[model samples]
Target: MSGHKRFWKAVSVAQENGLFEPRLDGRPIRLPQGKVLAVRSSALAEAIAGEWGQIAEGASFTPDSLPLTRMAGTMIERIAPDPQTTRDMLLGFGVDDGLCYCADGINPVAEQVFAWLSGYGIHPSVTDGLMPVVQPEGYLEAVGQLLATQGDLDLAVLGVLAQATGSLLLSLAVVGGAVSLVDAVLWANNDEKSQLATWGQDDELVRTMENREKDILDAGMFLTLGRQVSI
Candidate 1:
């Protein structure tokens, strides 16, 4: 029975010290670069195994197919191995933090956006775009402080989302207790929404929103399961 399965039929957790790892057929799984896929968070490790378990249901072995597992491997192989690059890349998202943009006309999300900014004392400037006049040092510093307390795997997850989305605000809000990533992305996309309102919603716009929504959802889900990342 198990012999017919395309992937490992036996999925398990390896508990040691105070961490957990996924074991396939009683052997620990390794990344493509041969690094063991251990994690400080039991929940995260099990979630990674679940991604692998799906291969048993079907027969594809692409990294994209196993995004979460790929996330673990990425954390171990790429992000973890280079902390300076990772930090630089993560912090680099602030150069165009989503909150900096504003709609020339009526941006529905402006109130919500400014409300979040009020607490941070950022005011808008009107020159090139209706943007936050202030630079993002304060916001980036706050995110850096929170990131300073996380594990590599969690940092990798947030990094993937942050870099992909190009907004440290979303990463920091989702990682910390500031706001939900969904609301954050929605606010970020307010300019897009304004464009759609003026130009009308089309297939291309819909697909763009779909992809962004997926990224935001993925980041939020990872953070939800990753409470121990902060611990």
Candidate 2:
């Protein structure tokens, strides 16, 4: 089966089990829901790797032409490149200015990441609870919300969404937390029906989810920032 179809199948399963009604940021997302999203996304990531590879292929600009942070800086600047041949090279992954690109909502790193992913055809927006929530512009707040509710099943749904949208990086953020949350739930699912059982098992689940909280924080600090910070 095609990648897109497979992705949709995943979503269908998730939804059938009451998992999701995909949402891109705030608006409802109905196209290419699951595995298809993952395949296209992988294709996009490979494409980005290819484009960067080509750029660094034969050219080696000196410190003047290429500063210490050359790659990171140039990549950041190219968030909105001049239209031309390279446009196709990126395959439409990028931002087109947010609600107010220059206003309080404008964040260069977040915008660049958003644009880059969108360029590859992944649409990202705010998601809260069971709805595709839309945040103002900051990436941290939205991500925090998803992570905050890790045990609520939203994280898994969001993971499926991230997989579909081809945001593996972001998926990492959600999945890392969601997996533990799901595991905790499964553990609780095994407990008895009595109050004592609920207290013991439910508390264990909360503790498990809480312990992994740092994973989400780490993701926020590193993944949300991107490759520059690592350097």
Candidate 3:
């Protein structure tokens, strides 16, 4: 809900059916689809509640202020409903992953990321040009199997990371803790950075880059909080 006034007097967390629910004024918060928002992780619920709590009374707010809540809703309403579809969507990001089409020599980050995927038996073809390289069926199947193992929340975070960086390799690396968020952003934007260096800064490009950074950081935090054991 964008441009809505903060109507709740207080924000809190409630335990329900062994799940954690963020409450507003003693009532559980509902997703956009009208379902109560319940999460398996207490830490995630608390953090989501904190987002609501931070809004000043009578102040205007937007959904952008509730990144974790949106992600949680996506987990419940989207990923949980049809996991196979979600897995396919995520796996498609790997098909034309930016890391695999570097124009320059092999990227160190790509090398590390490919090695990591290799452990899962997913070996994508890398090329030094813009032409599309068809990844083998075995490679795609392996990646799909790997994605199938991730929980809904993990897939939600991976979706955000993949969209933000346009690189499934970087997304996996970030989720695996093999790459820092800062470095991931840098690696994702290397081409843009090089262009900016030559052609000078564009305000729109800078803003786009900033937004990407925010998205990556938010997803990273969401995954970290969601993984915490409920207590």
Candidate 4:
């Protein structure tokens, strides 16, 4: 007998209007806004259902336990409804992109970031950590346009990545396959790692970094699964 007392005995996917819906005990799951949760990718729907199915009935759990579900809900309830707001929020990160800020006048990862952005015709200005770097108007416009091209799901995933890493460039790099998720995490935590080297390692800080890495990886998986075509 399974100790996991799940609320739903079975999980299934329903196809409607070319979108997939995950059902709990034959009832469609609804988002926070009361809309039935549906996604363009059947794979994503299944993954979301898997999260729900894994929940133990009468067992404690939080939103953090359901990353895929939370992301899918975000796509439906937030990003899909007002894409411009989300796009602008993501673009805002570029204005003071973490990669552009160099402490001690040196950022080892800046050259790689520059090369990645070059593919999209964006050349951002870099500056020492002392002052904020104002990105060019053209660069902002280009980044906005690039973000606009992303679908709701991609935007949602990018939002997670940007929030986790605090750098739109690193998020975009992950999306564009310009860098591995490992590299992105490493680059994003470069300053912190440098500090850890100077100061003794703090267990709490290390734990926080590990959680952040997991979030980034989860976002990457969500993006990949969401892009898959249902057979």
Candidate 5:
């Protein structure tokens, strides 16, 4: 099965068996499923490295051996590690590239994220027309909490969504997989196109997009009229 389908299946099974009831809400939230996908994805990536490096890790394992349960162990290890690299890896490019999307999309939430980063001297700017709306008494602490949760969610969603929908990042992975001369050049150009493509469609992409919206909501970032201010 495709990674996204497999991930949802695993989550559905685990939920049915009550394995995820403890850490998740009773309403069947996607967080547990997301976590499972994250660990499985990382383990798969590591296994790929082992394959290329000739290390023989999990040489006999089947496709069912999704090792996503271990991702929680690496959470603390990644926190505050390398912001630039993490942003690039998650967004399929650098912070600047993400900002470009924010501007193009006129995504208020992403603008707020950039604004928050800029407050810490990151100074992420918008080239097209994207700009953060200003607000007063902004809950920086609440924003931090939301960002922490989002950090975890993005790791899971990015890989699965990209794989499901042939996103730019997945194109990069495909290029890495080609492992040949002429294929690399063609793959590079394809990756460029994928990166610059519009993103209004793709159901899987909406999962991550919805998660971002929820993060903003959970962070109490909305103003009195239930609208996001340009804070």
Candidate 6:
């Protein structure tokens, strides 16, 4: 019942400037707008090729099934539209990082969050108010430095992960090998998870956490898969 048809007999990857390009039938693939489809990651390129390779002679594929390739396109078409826009977006994630907040308790989850913050060179000081105040002076510069070499797609997914985790630092931790994707998500939701544990779970909170978990996993796994890339 698939309406897709394969008109090409072969799919291959070509290298360019430390990036990878997908080729079909000895010709490089193009975007829907006829622009060249390229990626800065070998693993990602191979993954895209695998998507195309999986299509049977008569089978069709959908965008939903090709998230990796779609993200590559989105990177070129949307995320890195301009240098200023990307910089601003990167700064947005650093403004209100999740690690800057505390749960007002001595629980293990909160303690763990404090530990990661300390590891990242952030030291919290007791304030005059009822809450602890922390400023991530180094977070902005670190994330911006990360953006220096990251292609559009990398920034796009990092933004997604940052928003999902409510902490650019955590997302960077995921990208920088400081923590696993699942651990990052679990930590991001630590406060809520702890609260929900004793108070009971509500549909809204549960659903929100579920979606965040999925986004974190998708973005984090994509980054992990790209780790093998030579660049």
Candidate 2 per-residue C-alpha lDDT over 54-166 given as tens digits, one digit per residue, 9 for 90 to 100: 33333543322311122222322332232222322222221221221222343443344455444333345533234334434644434343244343122223333232333
Which residue pairs clash in candidate 6?
none
Off by over 4 Å in 3: none
Residue lDDT tens for model 1, 1-231 = 123334566888898666678888888887778888787778877887787677755464666556666666777888877766777677767656664554354244444544554555544332346444456446556545555666665676677677556666556555655566667677655656878999996788777877777767766665556565536
Provide the lowest-lDDT 10-residue window in model 4: 1-10
Model 4 lDDT per residue over 63-101, tens place: 788899888889899998899999998988988888777
Clashing pairs in 5: 39-68, 40-68, 133-230, 133-231, 134-230, 134-231, 135-231
Using all chains and alpha carbons, the TM-scores for the candidates as numbered come to 0.74, 0.18, 0.95, 0.90, 0.26, 0.67
Q: Please provide, for model 6 over 136-223, each residue's C-alpha lDDT reduced to its tens digit, 9 standing for 90 to 100.
A: 4675565566557666556767777877877766666566566677677777677678779988968888888887887787776566
User: Tens digit of lDDT per residue, candidate 3, span 104-161?
Assistant: 8777887788788878888888788778978887877787788878888889999999
List runs of model 2 lying over 4 Å from the truth.
Answer: 1-201, 229-231
Which candidate number maximizes TM-score? 3
lDDT of 4: 0.83
Candidate number achieving the greatest lDDT relative to the actual structure? 3
| Regions of model 5 farther than 4 Å from truth | 1-67, 70-92, 102-105, 129-231
TM-score of 5: 0.26
Better of 4 and 5 by TM-score: 4
* Model 2 alpha-carbon miss at residue 127, Å: 20
Query: What ranking emerges by lDDT with the best candidate at the front?
Result: 3, 4, 6, 1, 5, 2
Candidate 1 lands at a TM-score of 0.74
RMSD of each: 4.8, 21.2, 1.4, 3.4, 16.2, 5.0
Pairs of residues clashing in candidate 1: none
